[model samples]
Structure formats: structure tokens, C-alpha cells
Target: MHGVVQHSLIILAVLTSLGVIFGLVLAYANKKMAIEVNPLIHIVEDVLPKGQCGACGFAGCMAYAEAVVTNPDVPPNLCTPGKDPVAKLVGDLTGKAAAAVEPRIAQVKCAGTHTKAVKANEYHGVQDCVAANLLFGGPKSCKFGCLGLGTCVKACPFGAMTMSEDGLPIIDPDKCTGCAKCETVCPKKVIAMMPIGAHVRVNCNSHDKGAVAKKACSVSCIGCTLCVKECQYGAIKMDNNLAVVDAKVCMEKCDNPTCLAKCPTKAIRQAVLGIVPGNEETVA
Candidate 1:
């Protein structure tokens, strides 16, 4: 019995010694391998929008903050969520000049909601927009139109986007960080990033000819070039039967939206300003 007791005590002592040795080794390794966090990281983080939207090509706001302070190549204006305010804060923190960043927001190029656009085929399986798009350019007859499966709405980390009852995604400009997540997720590439306050936008994405577009979606731009003729500012241009509005020129000279009224399909829409006609006071 005494021998067994001695053996047990010996085993306990050996285990205790091993535990102490491993503890010291761990402490030494931790001290040697400890990563030194940059002081600017916290400063940059405080200035961030805290949206963690990943619009800056980083995982989140914290990750972006680390990159900005640690990596010289990472631009201070990379955070789209924070926009100008965040950029200015980051620049002040890092002692670098904040680069000029144009204010932008997501715009759905296609106005072909379920009610506005006729479906080409009925989808039976997955409800994902990417999945639906894989089967012959989506269920819509217009190849370039939104799939309306809410892929973009799902992709947005912020609750900035919601799928309307019409099955088209609508963006709340107030909430949007201009992260371009929706733009990236859209398989049809129908989402565009445009200036936030710009008055005019081309609501159609179809590159098809006039007759073809007319047959596909009632609201699709038929490339009639009516907008080109109506614009006194040279803001409207015809490209592949689609009227593209140059926001900069339109803001400067095209105060009137004769283009909006003249568009047979109503493809051109005034941005956040909404459906106010030309020669009327714009609603705030």
C-alpha cells in the first residue's frame, strides 16, 4: 500500500512539473510572437462608419481600419460606408490628405418589375437570382433586365435594399453605403453606381434593338434617341439603342426633364428628386 501511495505521489509530482514547464513555454512564446497593433488602427476605426459593409474591398470596418494604418498602399478613401466624413477622419488620423471621392449610390438600371415586364419562362426550382440567371439569361424576355429574384437585396449587408411587390429591388439612398455589393452580385449586371443627387438615370439595361426591346419589356428603352434630341445640354447619348444620361452634364445644363416626359417607355427617371416635371419646383 505504501509503495502504491509513493507511486501515486510520484505521478502527481511529474504531472505538476510538466504543467509548470508547459506554462512557461507558452508564456515565452506569447511574449515573443505578440503582434504589435498600430496606434492608428484604433484612430481609424473610430472614424469609420461602423457599417462594416466591406465596400472598401475588406471584410469589415475593423479590417479596413487595420489595412489603412498598416498598409501604405491602402487608400484612406477606401471606405465607401463612411464616405467623405470617414475619409476626412482617416486622413486626419493618418496625417495624409484625403483623396477626393465622388459620392455615389446604387441605381437599378432595369425598371422591368414583374408587373412591368412579361416573363419569358416560369422558373420551377431555386429562387436565387444567380441560379435563375444560369438557365438562359433569366426568366425575363429582356436578357439585360433584373432577374427580380432578390439576389441584390439578399447581398446587401445593410438593410438598404428591399424587393418591391413588383419584384424589382428598390434602394433606400439613406441606408446605402454604395458598397457595390449589389452591383457585383447581379448576374445580369443591371445595377449601376451613380451620383447620389443626379437628376436623370437610364432605367433600362437592354442593349437589344428597338423592336426587340419593345416586344420584351414595355418600359425598356427602345433606343428611339428621343432623349438625345430633347437634351439641350448634350447629356443624353445613344449607345446600342440605349440612352445613357451623363449625370455631370445633366446636372449642369439639363434643368428640364423633357427627356423624362418624351421617353415613350418612361425609361429615364429623375433620381432621388423623383417624378417632378420640368418647369416645376423640385421637391426636397
Candidate 2:
């Protein structure tokens, strides 16, 4: 019993001595190796939205903040969620001019909802959009339309997108961070990033000629170039039966609603301005 007691006391003494030695080592290391954090890091982080959406092409909000604080070339307006206010704050913190950034939102280019598009064949496997797209351009007759698999909705970390009744995704612009995650996930390339407050967008993604597009979907662009002819500002152009609008040019020169009325497919939607009378629900 005495021997066991002596061993226990020795073990306790050894443990106490080791603890003291470790404590001193930790204190010395802390004093010698402590890093001096930059004050600008905190300032930059304060102005950030804290959403960490990665819209600024960085890993997260903290990383973007650090880059903005340390790098002179990094623009202050990289945070899409913070918008102009955060830009101004960043500019103040960094002592740099805030670059003017045009706000953009995601829009679904394809209007080929389940009702409008005929199914090419039944898919029997996974419900993932990317997976479905690999199987002969998905189940829809319109090869370049949304697969209605909710891939974009799933990719969105902000919960900004929801599947509509027609099986197409609808984005809540108010909630969207403009992170471009949806634009990346779409297999059909139907989702596009466009300037916020733009008047109109071509909803159809079909590149087939008029009759061919018409057979596939009811509201496909027919490459008629009617919009090109109608626009006085030369904003609209026809390429592969798709109408592309230069938003800056369209905003400056094309204020009239003639093109919306002239489109046979009614695929172009004037989202900002009210639709003209007698063409309220037109497809183009």
C-alpha cells in the first residue's frame, strides 16, 4: 500500500511539473509569434453584406473584404448584395473611387414551359438537370429550354428561385444576390444575367428557323428580324432565329413599344414598361 501511494504522489508531481512547463512555453510562443492584424481588414469587413454569396468572384465575404482592403486594384463595388451603399463605404475605407457598377439580375430566356413544349421522351433516371441534359438534350422538344428539374433553384443559396406552375423557374429579384450560380447550373443555357431595370427580354431560346421553331414550341423566335427593322436605335439583331437586344442601346434609342406589338411569336416581354393595349398577353 505504501509503495502504491508513493508511486501516485510521484505521478502527481510529474504531472504538475509538466503542466507548469507547458504553460510557460505557451506564454512565450504567444508573445513571440502573435501577428499584428491590419486595421483595414476590420473596416472592410464592416462594410460587407456578410452574405458570403461569392458574387465578387472571391471565396466569401471575409476574403473579398480582405482583398479589397489590401489590394489597390480590387474594386470596392464587388459586393452585389451591398450595392451602391457598400460600394461607397468601401471607397471611404480604402480611399479609392467607387467604380460605377450596373446592377444585374438573372432571367430565364426559355419560355418553353411544360404546356408549351412537347416531351421528346420520358426520362427514367435521376431528376438532376445536368444529368437529364446529357441524355439527348433533355426530354423537351425544344432542345435549348429549361428541363424543369429545379437545378438552378437548388444551386441558389439565397432561396431566390422557385419553380413556377409551368415547370420553369421564376427568380425573386429582391432576394437574388446576382451570384450567377443559376446561370452556371443551367444545362440549356436558358438563364442569362441582364441589367436590372431593363425594359424587355427575348424569352425564347430556340435557334431553329421559324417553321421549325414553331413546330417545337409555340413561342420560339423565328429569326424574322422584325424587331431589327422596328428598332430606330438599331438595338435589336437577329442571329440563328434569336433576337438579341443591346440593353444600353435599347435604353438610349428604343423607347417606343412598336417591336413588342410587331413580334409574331410575342416572345419579347416589356417587363419595365406596361404592355400596349390589345397585346397584353402576346407570346413574343
Candidate 3:
């Protein structure tokens, strides 16, 4: 018993000594290897919206904060969710000129509703847009149209997105921080970021030919080029059998938009820039 006690004491002493030596080494290494992060990074980060949406091209708000503070080349206005006010604050703190961040909002490009769009099949799998898209571009006959699985609604960090009774996502421009979280998460790429002051929008994502698109969804852009020809400002263009509206051109050049009237399918829509139409129903 005495010998065992001595051996145990010796073992404990050796362990204690090893632990102390390791602790001292780690402490020294930590002090020497520590990279002093700028205190201003935290200050900048505090001004951020903390959406961590990665709209600024960084991984998260902290990464942006570090880049904005440490890198002179990085512009402080990269935080899309933070908008102009936060840009100004970050600029003031960093002594950098923040170019005016054009106020932007996310808009659902597809206007296909439950009644308007024909479903190819019924989906009973995982309730995710990305997952749904994997099984043959979702149930929607229009390959590029919104899947309407509430993935964008779930991904929205600002709570700007909501599902309509018509099976489409409605974006409240007021609540949207323009983080583009919904835009990034959407498998169909149906959500788009638009300038806040722009009124004209092409509410279709289907690039299928005119008859094919019409067959898939009643509101799909038929790519007739009527809107393009009608626009005196050259605002509308055709690409991939879809009408693309140049919002800036339409806003500045044409007061009375004739494209809205010319679109046979009524896919081109004009709305009050900041106001969302209907009670959670997207403008169709």
C-alpha cells in the first residue's frame, strides 16, 4: 500500500508538471501569435444589419467588417442590407467615400399563380425549392418559373417574403432589406433585385417559346417583341424568348408606359415602385 501510494504521488506530480509546462507554452504562443484585429471592425460591424446574407460578397457580417476596416480597397457600401444610412455611417467611421447605394428591392419575377400555371406533376417530397427543383425542375410545367415551396419565404432574413393563396411568393418592398437572400436561395432564379424607383417589371421567368410558354402559364412572357417595339425609349428587350425591361430607361424616358398595354399576355406590369399590390398576392 505504501509503495502504491508513492507511485501514485509520482505519477500525479509528473502529470502536474507536464500540464504546467504545456499551459505555459500555449500561453506564450497565444500572446506571440495573436493578430490584433482593429477595434473599428467591431464598430463597423455594429452598424451592420447582421443579416449575414452574404450580399456583400463576404461570408458574413464579421468578414465584411474586417475587410472594410483592414482593406483600403474594400468599399464600405458593399452591405446591401445596410442600405445608404449604414453606408454613410461606415464611410464616416472609415474616412472613405461611400458612393450612394441605389435603393433596391427584391421582386418575384414569375407571375404564375395556381390558376394560371399548369403543374406537370404533384410534388410530395422534401419541402425545399432546391430539393424540389432536383426532381425535374419541380412540378411546374414552366421550367424557369417559381416552385412555390416557400423556400424564398423561409430564406428571407428580413421577413419580406410570404406565400400567396395563389401559390406564389409576394415581396413586401417595405420589409425587404434587399439582402438578396431569397434571390440566392431560389432554385428557379425567379426572385430579382430591382431599383426601388423603377416601376416597370416583366413578371415572367419562362424562356419557353411564345406558344410553349403560353401553354405552361397564362401570364408567361411570350417574347412577341411588341413591348420592345412599342417602347419609344428602347426600354424592353428580348433574350431567351423572354421580355426584359430596362427599368431605368422606362422610368426616366417614358411617363406613360405603353408596353403594359402592348404585352398580349399582360406579363409586363406597372406598379407603384415601393408599394406591393394585393393582400400578400404578387402583382400578376
Candidate 4:
């Protein structure tokens, strides 16, 4: 028994010694091979929103901070969630010329409410939009319309989206950070980023032909090309049986918007400027 105990102790001691030696070697190697991080990276990252929504085309805020500080090619204004104020701060820190960040907000392309849009079938499985969309392009008769499953609402890092009683998503422009998380997660591609300054916007995304689109949804764009013809600035265009508005051009040049009057189904509507969503009071 004494000899066996002695052998066990010897074996333990040998294993312990080997472990300590390997640990020391690893510690030394780690110290020697460690890459020095620039202090400016942390400083830049500190000013970021830190939502890590990947809106800036980087993996996270830390990666963006490193790129903006180390890479001259990376723009400081790439942080969409941070807006112009944060962009200015990053640009100042990096000593780069900061261009004015265009303020953007997520807009719902489809105006199809429960009453307006026809239902093809009722969903019985998961409540996720992506999952429902996979099953025969969702329950909506219009395949391009919002699934109304609240996937975008859940995905939003910022509290910008909400489901209306009408079975449509209402976007709060004030809360929207333009992260595009809602847009990215939407399987129907109903959500889109639009400039906050844009007043006139198309409320439909359906690509179905005039009669077919009307049958699916009352407000679907019918590709009449009337908006394009009405606008002297050439801002509106018909693409895949839908009317698209160039907000920049329309906001800049067009004063008398006859296109809003020209849309037969009223798919194109102007947002009542300064009116906050969910508020009954009109902004005077």
C-alpha cells in the first residue's frame, strides 16, 4: 500500500509540473504575440450606438470602430443608427471629412389592411413571417404584401415598428434608427428605408398586372405610369408593375404634385408631414 501511494504521488507531481511548465510557456507566448490595439478604436467605439445591428456593413460596433480608425477607405458616416450627430463625432475623432448623413426611416411599402387585402388562406403554424412566407408565399392574396406576423416588429433593435389594428405595420419615424433590421428580416420585402424628408411615397409593392393587382389588394399599384407622366421632374417610374418615387428629386423640385391625384387606386399617398404615428391629433 505504501509503495502504491508513493507511485501515485510521483505521477501526480509529474503531471502537475508538466501543467505548470506548459501554462508558463503559453502565458509568455500570449504576451509576446499579442497584437497591440490602437487606443483610438476604443474611443471611437465608445461614441457608437453599440446596437451591433450590422447597419454599417460591419459585423459589430467594435469592428466598425477598428475599420474607421485604421482604414482610410472606411467612412465614419457609415453608422446609420447613429445618424448625423454620431457621424460628426466619429469623423471628428478620425480626422475625416464628414458628409451630412441623410436621415432615413423605415417605411412600409404595403398599405393593404385586413379589409382591403383578400386572404388566400389562414396560417396555422409558427407565428414568424419568414416561416409563414415559406408556406406558399404567405396567407395574403398579394404575395408581395406584408405577412402581418410581427417578425419585423420583433427583429427591430429599436422600437420603431408596431402592428396596427388594421393588420398592417405602422412605423414610428421618431423611434426608427434606420438600422434596416426590420427591412432585412421581412420575408415579403415590404419594409424599406426611406429618407425622413420624403413626403410622397408609394404605399404598394405588388407586381401583379393592373386587374390582377386590384383583385388581390385594393391599394396595389397598377403601373399606370400616370405618376411618371404627371411629375415634370421625372422622379417617378414604373418598375415591375409598381410606381416608385424618387423622394430626393420630388422633395427638391416638385412643388405641385399632380401624381397623387393621378393614381387611380390611390396607391401613391403623401404622408401628412410632422404627424406622429398613433396620434389622432393633426399637426398644425
Candidate 5:
């Protein structure tokens, strides 16, 4: 009985010694290999709204925080969703100049709908716009028009985009962070980032040249260069047979925009649906 008791005690002592040795090793390893986190990173991260929208060019708010905290040159105004207030806070924290956030929103270029744009072939395979586009430039006659397959709507991480009943993507300005995700995801390149204050814009993306474009979709830009000619300010220019409006020159020089009245097919328009008013938000 005494030998049994001594054996049990010996086993307990060995186990206790092993545990202590492991504890010491673990402590030493932790002290030597532990990553040191900067307090400023946490501070900057807390100030941010944590949208993880990647508008700041970083993967997330934490990544941005680490960048701004560690680097003196990284600008704080890259956060589009944070707006002016966040910019100011980041600037104050990092001692960097807070550049004013330009108000930008996504604008869908195609006005071609299910009824307006003539169908070349009925797509029956997949609902994906890119997938549909792979099979002979999509079902729509206009090669550059939006496929209305909800690819953009699905790509939007912020729930800023939606598809209308007429088969067109609609972006809510309030929810949009101007992340340009939809623009990147769109296979047609139909959606583009536009200044919120931009009054004049070309709604069509078709480069079909004059009559061929008109036949495909009624609202498609025929690329007649009428808008380029009518712009008194030289704000409008022709690129790839399409009317390109320079917002900088247009805002300053376009007091009497005759371009709106000059478009023959109503292709060059004020970026609106139904009633093309002089000043109103446009629809796709």
C-alpha cells in the first residue's frame, strides 16, 4: 500500500513539473513572438464607421486605420462613405490634409428597355449579364446596352442598386458609396461614375454610328456629333463616334445649351427618363 501511494505521488509530481515547464515555455514564446499592435490603429479604427466598403482603397476600415496610423503620407479622405465629417476626424488624428470629398454617383448609360431595345435572340440559359453576354453579345440588338440581368444589383455590396420592372438597374444615391463596384462588374461598361452636380450627360453607350444604332434601340446615341457641334462652350467632344460631355467645361460654359434641342433622334439628352428636363436626375 505504501509503494502504491509513493508511485501515485511520483506520477503527480512528474505531471506538475511538466505543466510548469510548458507554462514557462509558452510565456517565453509569447513574449518573444507576440505582435505589437499600435494603439493609434485602434483609435483610428474606432472613429471610422466600419462600413468595410473598400472605398478608401483598403480592404476594410481596419486596414485603412493601420495604413493611416503607420504611414504619414496616406491621405485620410479616401473614405467615400465617411464623407466630410469622417475626413475631418481622420485628418485631425493623422495630421494629414483632408481633401474635400467630391460627390459622385453611379449613372447607368443605357436607356434601352425590354420594349425599346429590339431582341436579336431570346436568352434562355443563365440570368447572369456577363454569362448572357458571352453568348453572341447578349439578346439585345444594342451590343453596348445594359443586359438588365441584375449582375450589377448583385455586385453592389451596399444594397445601393436595384433592377426596375422594365429591366434596368436603378441606383439609390443615398445608399451608394461611389465604390465603383458596379462599374467594374458590368460587362457592357454601361454604368459609370458621374458627379452628382453634373447637369448634362450622354445617356447612351452605343457606338453603332448614326442609323444602325437608331435601328437597334430608339434612344441609342447615333453618334452624329450634333451635341459636339451645338455646344457653344466646346464642352462636348466625339470619342469612338459617341458624344462625350466634359462636366468641367459644361458647368462653366453651358449657359445656353442648344445641344439638348439639336439631337435629331433625342439621343443626346439631359440624362432623364420620359420628360428630358434641363435639370433633373436621369434614369437608365
Candidate 6:
């Protein structure tokens, strides 16, 4: 019994000694290898929404926070998800005046749903927009129309986008951070960021002029310029067989709203749903 006790003590002592030695080594290594992160970076990071959408030009919230603390050129209002409250907090913390972030929403440019847009062929392979787009520019007869494969829905970090029953994406303005992730991921480039209160918008993305565009999608712009001629304010312009609404003039400067009623195809119309961040039922 005495011999057994002696052996047990020796074993315990050896283990204790090894543990102490390793602990000290780890502590020394940690002190030497530690990267000096700014304390202010963590503060700014805490205030941030941490969506990591990369709208601020930085990689993520942490990287953005670090840049805000270190770089004077980096603005505090860059975080779209964080919006005004976070901007104010960041500005107060960093001692820099933050500008108010302009409210924007993801507008799915293609009004062409399955019912409106004609289909060339049915895709049976992978259920991804990026993948489907590679297959003969997708199943849709209109090459520019949304694939309706939920690639934008997947790409959006914020729960802002949803695939409608019509096989088109419906964007929730309130939830959308305007990070442009959906816009970037869309294979068809049918999603565009529009200012919240912008009155007139051309929902069609098809470049096919008149007859061809109308055959592809019922509601295509067709570059008719009927709305342009009707507009008292010279806000509408034809570019690449697409009607582009000048946001500054139409939404902000223009008083007489005639374009909405004049659009023959009803392509350029008044935004019915909430254009800015507000509570609205996006699912139909």
C-alpha cells in the first residue's frame, strides 16, 4: 500500500509539472503572437448590425469597423444594414460627422412572370439561376428575364427577397438592406436598386425592340418612348432599347406626373408597393 501511494504521488507530480510547463509556454506564445486590434474597432463592431453584406466596400463588419477606426477617409454611414442609428453612434464614437444614408430598395426589373414571359424550353437540371442561365441562356424566351430559380434569394444575406408564386422574385423593402447582393448574384441582371420614393420605374429589362420584345414578354418596355413624350419633365430617356427614368428629375424635381398614365405597355408606372423601407405584404 505504501509503495502504491508513492508511485501515485510521483505520477501526479509529473503530470502537474508538465501541465504547468505547457500552460506557461502557451501564455508566453500568446503574448508574443497577439495582434494589436484597436479597442475602438470592437466598439464600432458592436454597434454595427453585423450583416456582413459588404455594401460598405470592406470585406465584413469587423473589417469595416477596423477601417472606420483607423482610416479617416472611410465614412461611418457606409453600412446599409446599420442605417442611420448605427451611423450616428459610429460618428459619435469616431468623432466624425456621418451623412444620412439614402434609403433604397431592390426592385426586380423584370415584371415578366411565368404567365407574362414566354418560355423557350423547360430546364430539368440543377435548380440554380447561375447554373440554369448557362443552359442556353435559361429556359425563358426572353434572355434578360429572371430565371426564377432563387439565386438572388440565396445570395441575399438579409431576409429581404422571396420567390413569388408567379415564379418571380418579390423584394421586401423593409427587410432589404440595399446591399446589392441580390443584384450581384442575379444571372439575368434583372434586379436594380432604386430610391425608395422614386415615382416612375420601367420594370422591363428586355432590349428587343417593339414586336420582338412584346412577343417575348407582354409587359416589355419596347423602347416606345410614349411615356417620354408624355412626361412634362424630361426625365425619361431611351437607352439600348430600354426606357431609363432619370431619378433626380422625375422623383424629386418633377411635379406633373403624366408618364404613369401615358405608358402604353404600362411598363413605366407608379410604384404601387412600398418603394422605401416600410411594412408591406410582398408575397402574392
Q: Mind giving the per-residue lDDT tens digits that candidate 6 earns over 151-263?
A: 99988898888888788887877788888888888888888888878776778888888899999988888888888788777888898899998877887778767776777
Q: Write the per-residue lDDT of candidate 2 for residues 1-284, one digit (tens) a residue.
A: 99999999999999999999999999999999999878888878977877666789999888988898889899999887787888999998889899776778788887787777788899877989999989998898888878989999998878888887778888787787677878987888988888887777888888888888888888778888988898888888887779998887777666675788788878876753222211225523
Comparing 1 with 6 on TM-score, the higher-scoring candidate is: 6
Error of 1 at 134 (Å): 1.3
TM-score of 3: 0.91
Q: What is the Å distance of residue 125 in model 3 from its true position?
A: 0.7
Residues 61-157, candidate 3, lDDT per residue (tens digit)? Answer: 9999999998999998999888889999999999999998888888888878888889999999999999999999899999999888899999888
lDDT, residue 242, candidate 6: 91
Give the local distance difference test score of model 1.
Answer: 0.82
Better of 4 and 6 by lDDT: 4
lDDT of 4 by residue, 19-87 (tens): 999999999999999999999999999999988889999999999999999999999999999989999
Worst 10 residues of 2 by lDDT: 271-280
Q: Model 4, poorest ten-residue lDDT window?
A: 275-284
Poorly placed runs, candidate 5 (over 4 Å)? 1-31, 272-284
**TM-score for predicted model 5 compared with the true structure:** 0.83
User: In model 3, what is the error at residue 254, expressed in angstroms?
Assistant: 1.2
* Candidate 6 lDDT: 0.83
Candidate 4 lDDT (Cα, whole model)?
A: 0.86
What's the TM for model 6? Answer: 0.86
Query: Model 6: which ten-residue window has the lowest total lDDT?
Result: 275-284
Model 4, position 42: C-alpha lDDT score? 100
Alpha carbon deviation, residue 223, candidate 2 (Å)? 1.1
| 3 or 4, greater by TM-score | 3
Error of 2 at 264 (Å): 1.4
Per-model TM-score versus the true fold: 0.85, 0.82, 0.91, 0.91, 0.83, 0.86
All models: lDDT? 0.82, 0.81, 0.86, 0.86, 0.82, 0.83
